[model samples]
Target: MDIRVVACDIFGTTVDWYTGVAAQVAALLPEVDPGEFAARWRGEYAPSMDRVRTGEREWAYLDTLHRESLDGLLAGRPVDEPTRDRLVRAWHTLPAWPDSVPGLTRISAAHTTAALSNGGFALLTNLVKKAGLPFDCVLSAELAQAYKPDAAVYHRAAALLDVEPSQILMVAAHKWDLDGARAAGLRTAFVHRPREKGPRQEADRPEDVTADLHATDFEDLAGQLGSR
Candidate 1:
């Protein structure tokens, strides 16, 4: 599908969240293996996001999710209180995937690239600034008071952008993420991030006949989008 704009997911989509998170934990608890610790922390992501998404809990943002998850991870560990707080805040300062900067720079030169993520506005804004991303907008599921898979968030982003869903492409790494975006009327572009599963984890990209395009990453996606 041809689209003029893309609403990207920031964490798993554009950043190596697992590694970034692991690095922070490793830095805090020198005795803990970074990979193992990071995995445990990242493991808490879906459940926390689900809490906010399902209305089981109030609308807690991703930052809260990260903090809660970090607290839980440090429960039996040797992390001190101050270091735990600092480590949790590291989510706001995650380093982007190595390809993110150049890939987005080229794509944004021709498309209205924005983040349509579950992350709160403040979190996303800080992330973009830290990553030095060139985004035209920062659209959050928080603004819609809902999460991805909730069409309300997508519609809210489309409305704010003043564009029809058909013209907007939802670029994401997860199949469920793109599925929700497609159901919301946006076109879908899958950017496969194999590392999102962590080493030896076997979940592959979802099988979907509806995705408009599938690429290995942002660079592959840019190649498929052709010209302006």
Candidate 2:
């Protein structure tokens, strides 16, 4: 299919959220090694998502999840609530991948492009403004009260864009998100974010469908997706 729009996930997919979060965590905790703190902080991602995903608790945005996860990571540290609040707010100010702006700009010129991330509308909006992401729209799983890897979130993207799922391309660094999108009937593209796990972090060695196309980042995505 000739894709008319590209819907991308925000965290790790478009921006280096791990690096950004680690950077903030480092600055927030001068006593702790930023790199180690970042690794520990990110380590809680899945279990936290599981709480919302399995209906064990009400669905919450990534912001809340991050906070909940952070509290556990704090381990009775002397850090004040104010600094913690600032750290929680760091999710809103991620520095985009170097390829993010230029690639999205180039892609947007020819295709309708937007963020279809698990990040809430407000959170994603603030990030876009802070990072200068050239997204035409921001769609979130938050709108569906669910997270990615859920078919509902994938379908919501189509309804919000008022386009058929087949016409919208779901691009991500995670195969699980792409698999969900594919199962929900959207085409998929892979943007390799080898650093999503930080230095020497293991990348998913294989993908479900071998990704319709493979690229290193948004810029690579744009180049392969060019003039299509």
Candidate 3:
């Protein structure tokens, strides 16, 4: 396939949300299990997005969804308004995985690189800048007013990048996301992120997905993509 653009999913695919949010949770709410809390908070992510996807509610950005989820998770806990807000902001400050910057840098040198995320534009901007991810562009669900796995989101990325969906490589650790992209006519790359959920928790494995390419990490993906 002639891939001219690489569009990547952000959260668990590039950044270590489990570790980052868990660390913040551990620091902010010492009494609770950080790992469990982080998982629970993330568990709310899809359902929250589904609400909007299914038209159960109006379009809301990831930060607003995160804050709502955090508030629900911290119910009856001692977390105050200020603490809750900080916890929500922790998503903005997440650290990229070891391979993210280097791999993205290499790929960006060869192809147009775009951050395709369910996150809001502002949220992605802050995170991408802070993480130093070498993406040529940032695309968000906010652009389509729809979340990922929605055909519209992937289509919007292709449109904004001025490429055919078939010419774009959609990369993500989650098979569901890849499936969505594939349905939208995009090529797919499944990058394994085994620790995204936590060490003890087994994340998406290669056997669990089917894609145009399967990689161990972003660096591996860059190599497979013929990136220097």
Q: TM-score: which candidate is best? A: 3
- Residue 26 local lDDT, model 3: 95
**Candidate 2 per-residue lDDT over residues 110-199, each given as its tens digit:** 999989988889999899888899999888888888988888898888988788989989998888788889989999888887778787
- For model 1, what is the error of residue 8's alpha carbon versus the real structure, in angstroms, after optimal superposition? 0.6
On lDDT, the candidate that comes out on top is: 3
Model 3 CA lDDT for position 71? 83
lDDT of all predictions: 0.81, 0.84, 0.93
lDDT of 1 by residue, 1-228 (tens): 567788899988888777777777677778887877777777788888788777789887777788888887777766677887788777788778777777887789889999888888998999888888778889999889888878999899889888898889998888778889889899998877878756856444645435888888887777777632
Candidate 2 colliding pairs: none
Model 2 collision count:
0
For model 3, the superposed segments whose C-alpha errors exceed 4 Å read none
Model 3 TM-score (2 dp) = 0.98
**Candidate 3 on 112-209: residue-level lDDT in tens?**
99999999999999999999998898999999999999999999988888889999999999988999999999999999998999966788889989
- Candidate 1 local lDDT, residue 125: 92
Which regions of candidate 1 fall more than 4 Å away from where they truly are? 206-210
